[model samples]
Target chain A: MNHSVVSMDATMIQTKGLTRHFTVKKETVEAVRGIDLHVRRGELVALLGPNGAGKSTTLRMLTTLLPPTSGTAEVAGHDVVREQAAVRHRIGYIGQGNGAGHTQRGRDELVIQGRCYGMGRKAARARADELISALGLETVADRTVSTLSGGQRRRLDIAMGLIHAPDLLFLDEPSTGLDPQNRANLQEQILNLHTEYGTTVVLTTHYLDEADSMAERVIVVDHGRVIADDSPTQLKRDHAGDRITLTAGHTDDARRVADRARRSAGAEVTQSGTSVEIRVLGAPQLLPGLLVDLANDGVTVTGAEVARPTMDDVFLNLTGRSLREGGAEPADAGADGGADGGARAAADADGRTTQNQEIAA
Target chain B: MSTTVAARETNTALTGTAGPNRRRPSLLHDTGTVFVRELLPVLRNPFSVVFTMVQPLVFLGLFGPLLSDFPGTGEGSALQWFVPGIVVMSCLFSGAFTGSNLLFELQTGSHERMLVTPLRRSALLIGRALKEIVPMVMQTVIIVAVCMPFGFELHLAGAALAVLILAVMAVGIGALSYSLALASKDQDWLFWTIQQTLLFPFLLLAGILLPLDNGPGWLRTLGDINPLTYVVDACRLLFNGEIAAAGVLQGAGAAAFLAALGLLVGIRSMRHST
Candidate 1:
């Protein structure tokens, strides 16, 4: 299929220069700056960023929970600013917190929420049962949400958001607190939801692996603006630095071979205790040659491995700061006092990298 | 929690998932949804039910008899003179309790979820207000039952029905109080500050537990203008079966004024919240 042709007919969400800002204590913070984005129907777009990168704020605006400071956005063909009600009708937003009430039983709460959205009592009850089974919540459906584990509570939150069957879904940090297994389960569920319901999903996360494994497109934001948008493979080939870590049988042997390896590979090599680290571009393909040379020189190599670049590398390349370093630039980047400036920038940059990776692939 | 596509597909088939054929939910429908949800939590909370009913009964027990001997407390017994007060006060307190839940929901992000739903925004406040009203009425019934032991007689000649009507009006005022509190975003401290500043003049002017007739001329006029004073006056007449024509006018006016005020505030706040 022609990609642009399909995309033109499948625009489930589009935003142009969408902006939001807030002024606290006489200091203006621009959370979301001028930016353009598009998500096709049934597409799972991962928005990756560090904390305070305007991810939550962007979701809030898209879901109609917060008004945009300035800009135009349309979700499901409804204007976010002029037709907020219409936008709301088509989207389900699962916020950052565990949204389910701890005091109420999961089933009871779901039924009540369904009714609040105008479902008949009998219909709501039936929907509750179905969701409970679907989300694997049957065992604890009748129990208070407070008793559910972190993963279960998170699933319940997703269930509550989905009860209304909105066409577009927004999940902000859905797996932030989940264990690895639970996070994987959530990723599968999100993928299945997209296939089954044809729902367009936009989720924000701090985990690059999660973004790589799930999102069809990735958007990275930093300093309140988009820096990269691409697919995983293209980003890895284009912006990621090559990684080479070697462990030798002896520390002295590793040190003796490190300078020669750097001279041969023409890369920056550093030592960490018994292991040597080599960071280079296109170095993975050169590992065999390097290993052969090491053997000829009579240096015993216990272990050697080469790794391609990651979102972490892409992040460091663009922002000169690791994702763990709070992903923020200077405060001046958020001069408009928008809560989502940072998040939106991170999401946009991630998207760009993911797009680049896909192109390269 | 692991999820499967088959399960979601089955549920979608059963519930009629959103599509081109789906009808956009109307405002009335959305409000009804919010109203039902709000009532469910309140009805299920035993603590709220017990507190609402028991607190007023205690007041009737401790003070009703003592006030019977006081001049100008026209009634069959001490408890009878205070039955109407118990009903109004109980409804007001219950309404305040309901307001606290709304605040809690907002702070906890429950309200934020609702805002993103297809439901009408007004449903948030209106539904909550109605929830508070139902329990307030139920508490009024329980307190009236307890009042009967202390010679709390009701004029069986249709006059008892008048007191019930007063209870409804009091509930409306209470709803207004809760809606206002929610508008402040659970900033109960700010509410308390305002409450403290307005306390004395409001109490003296409204004459909630006392008669406006006992105040100075200007103060009496102020009390007459106060909605609660009129509510108190009407309760006295209706409970005693001394339903004078003027009593009906005074009570009806107060109730109408309160109902209108509450509705206005609730609607306006819900409309512009986000």
Candidate 2:
């Protein structure tokens, strides 16, 4: 066996220029472009992107499920390609689909998974019992996997991945097909497991709220490229901002207020009829002072509202497209934003008109 | 309190013995684990085993009496000559279709889960192939017993050797089936089309229905090329109380060769499947 020196640093996962490509209908599709990522030990990170954004592809490469087309990745301090077995032994991965066999009992599947990782028969049984109870799967663990509900099956998948208690865990869209209640329950279980075991957890999800509420660090990917990487709060603060909309007595007063907002550095001002919208960072502190100044200027302000940014806003500001709108165009069309400009502009206009109408109503 | 004990036990079970640096289990140990896992479903649902034997039993009842008056079958009850060929046929049909299970697993993502473990790649294929033996043995026993009351002589030692040869052949066919499944992962039609296309030719050329001795010279040449012919001939001889015959050695050699070749291709495909 070939042995390479394992990195002694606290880094749990590191990838440099890692890439993957596929051939579909004789055309080469680059699923994952050059991506450099580092995940420290015990950190919870989420790869946030829409469909076809290469988030799952990047996680697949790190988990040693798919070989990188170029560049290198080291997972759990072992080279993903050269020391694959060592890396596999040290990490657990739950892919997008359910991983347990349909005919086997959930408990039996967990035990066999433990055995695959070289646990003794008695020890594997003990661990299976532990996970069965710990994941609240005792009721369903004895039933066939296919008989369990989606949430139960997903939890069993998690238990299968954790049978060996690997130091690092990778989850690919773990909550894609579940209802909101089940999705929240699964998230709580994942968070609890992460806290108790101190496992380095990396998961990919398109659910903005899931990532926003769960992961400490969120990496935004689109069209096979990493567009932004930061803490969720920092990302919202940097890429998106609060929207402060004011309705005035007349169109002239709205126009005057827009001019004043334009004077504030980096505030994006849009005026329509008697309403003015100001997009700026820190609306909570700036809105009150702007209202008092307007009072002093004798401009009757009829309405005022401030809306904070969501993760969807962070993604929209980075890509000029909403993550809630499902599909992401390929790199050729999306790179220049030429083909998708009209649709994106219409969506933005519709959003603003709807917000203004709601304020009027 | 019990939850805490379970948690502590989990910690020790993970860190104390099953660490990353722990030595990997032997290939045989991993194969046994896979074999047991594969066998559990079959054991739980025994109806499938009986269902698989339905076609062989139908062939025996409808086709055996017609073979009695056929030429070149030699001087013996037709059941003796036909039962061994039926065993071979049953093995062929059952073993060649085993890949569909793997195809289902691949679709469900269970196979991908197994690949991420530290288990040896060869063990996955080998253990699956070995699992075909249990049902093959059971079908053979039932086929032999069903023919006994109809004047079929029971040659214990020769029949045992015949079972061994059939088991080897079944392993070979099962391995090839799994390799085909892996090759045609998303396109299930390819696996079925190939399996169905090749199945009858191998069966007819091997003379499992009627002796190929009276056929045309070109047919004899085709039979010589088809490896199943030797296995069928060898099994027929062994079941007829002629365990010392030279055809038995050639059949064993052919079966072993197929097993080795199937395993080689199967293991390679399993390793590179993703």
Best by TM-score: 2
Clashes of each: 55, 0
Q: Tens digit of lDDT per residue, candidate 1, span A1-361?
A: 1122224567888899988665433335566776688888888888887776767767777887667779988887778878887777567788776666656678888887776556677877777777777777889988877789988888788888877776678998888889898887788777877876667889999898888888888898755567788886677656776888888888887996696677864587898767998887778677888888888888888888888787888887777678765546543445543444444444433432222222223
Query: Residue by residue across B33-61, what tens digits does model 2's lDDT show?
Result: 89988888788776688787888889999
Could you tell me which 10 consecutive residues in candidate 1 chain B have the lowest summed lDDT? B13-22
lDDT, residue A183, model 1: 83
lDDT, candidate 1, at A224: 51
Taken over the whole model, the C-alpha lDDT of each candidate is 0.69, 0.83
State each candidate's chain A TM-score: 0.79, 0.87
Q: Could you give the DockQ of candidate 1?
A: 0.34
Q: Name the TM-score of candidate 2.
A: 0.89
Cα RMSD over interface residues, candidate 1: 9.3
- Error at A328, model 1, angstroms: 3.4
